[model samples]
Target: MQVQKTTIPHWSEDDRPREKMMLKGRNSLSDAELIAILIGTGSGMKSAVDLGREVLLLTNGDLYEFGKLRLSQLCEIKGIGKSKAVSILAALELGRRRKEIQTEKRPKIDSSEKAFKELRGYFTDLSHEEFFVMYLNRANELIQVKQLSIGGISGTYVDPKIVFKYGIDVGACGIILAHNHPSGNLKPSESDEKITKRILQFGDLIEMPVLDHLIVTDNGYFSFSDQELL
Candidate 1:
């Protein structure tokens, strides 16, 4: 009688995810294949690639949606234990940090366009509301980016004192405030306008200019400075 080989063992060496990535390059791999490489192996009856396909299905093939998944949420999926879920989350965070570092290298925020380009990536994939501040030096170079608050999908609160305090702490001469509307609306609410004016007034008193307030959504952004609202 002929011996039967397991599915993974039967896969051609060049066709294996890790080997394929090594041979063809990472960009050549599909999303499922890349996830399979991270997952390492699969649960009962599923190949790693097959399990990865299921995960992609769960996120509707959007990597940003996948990135938002919590460890507990990921663990709920078959074949994803705590270890595997942690690996995926760690990988996603590393990618985010890498992008942040690259952006920081070009930290100039001279115009609303530049500010939007720099700040949009941080808010693009978030499911909840997050208010962030980018502190700038005298020359408009970014000193640091800090998250002021996180709230539910509808809105988040930003303390003017805390915002200025971060500016003082970072020795920032100017600052740009930003937050995302998860609903993908670029229109600023009344509260958004009120907060921007308040922060602008406070910045004037502190000698730290509020360069802009950006309302970012997945599709686009609304810039207070660009619209002469700041």
Candidate 2:
């Protein structure tokens, strides 16, 4: 059987991808339009937009996750040959590099909320236990937020040493330890008590105060310090 050709129209002032981009702005473009701008054209049967849609759906709407796929996997798309696959991958890498460069000039950790905002988006649907350490400066401004452990909803392991080492290494004057229960219970548990006591003791030795131990859930929060445990 012979393959039939599908033709794209000649570039025109009103319809050209670059002109449309300049007139409407990048943000105004649909996902397919944005991808078509990158890919330039379609193959025998499909438009670049249709090809890009297939790629996105295969990766569950995350382009970064799609980039993790092998080049052979990308080339499996009917219209995406090895060169086109490489172009897509190169575009992804350029985006990744640009983001890294923009964020690397200075690392800012302003507050516990700001430091942990990344976690909020990612953890909204988690079904297991998770823990985080928030390192703070003398003024209680955040320096870093680290995930120390993740376990089943009722169980987790967190090393006081690992948590404190970051504090000591960063010369943090204080720390706010926090974690979430997927069950939405902000109340501290026996294990939570044990870990808090151990971490507080470690902090005391180095003169780095553990300002507050907070158990925050999607529903609300509970503070051991607020309860006079600190």
Candidate 3:
């Protein structure tokens, strides 16, 4: 006779994944354990944690890489069906949104590094190119960050008038421009330079300053002000 596999329900409370979570807390669980809670079960022989390990193993145990997986790719793992794959993707999307929400809080952005950190969170959900501008008070603290336009992977159109107009409407003293390079190229292209110049000209016309132009990506960022390109 074959021995039945031990299920999570059968394990003692502390040893059980869900119970372990309730007792200790979320941080107390490992990556695999957290995934196991999403899974709840596995193929006949493998336990939930085992299936979770397989999920991580498929992505080489990189959470960043894991978040980038397509739903169909996630379903490739044994015992992970359409429902489980959707759940995983939903959780990852929620995490990204949380980062964005945290950034929405007012923060002083005095340097390019600080601006990049504050603004990059807005780009986490973008798979294509989009432009944004951060309005700032005279003190260099952020007033608001607003999307200018969206485009295909190659580039985006940023109308200079709308950018500065919004800043004026919001009573901003200055603005910082930002856009994402979906190809992960941190270098600002020729068009990027031309647009920056155009916006700077408009800002000059109005006495509102274009303080910086940032080309940001998942890996890093490029800054016009830092390069003295402005």
Every model's TM-score: 0.87, 0.56, 0.89
Error of 2 at 206 (Å): 3.3
The better-scoring model by lDDT among 1 and 3 is 3
Q: In order, what lDDT does every prediction score?
A: 0.87, 0.72, 0.88
Ranking, lDDT, top scorer first: 3, 1, 2
Query: How many backbone clashes does every candidate have?
Result: 0, 0, 0
Candidate 1 residue 197 C-alpha distance from true site, Å: 1.4
User: Between prediction 2 and prediction 3, which has the larger TM-score?
Assistant: 3
- Models sorted by TM-score, best on top: 3, 1, 2
Residue-level lDDT tens digits of model 2 in 135-178 = 77776655666778898977678898898888888878888888
TM-score of 1: 0.87
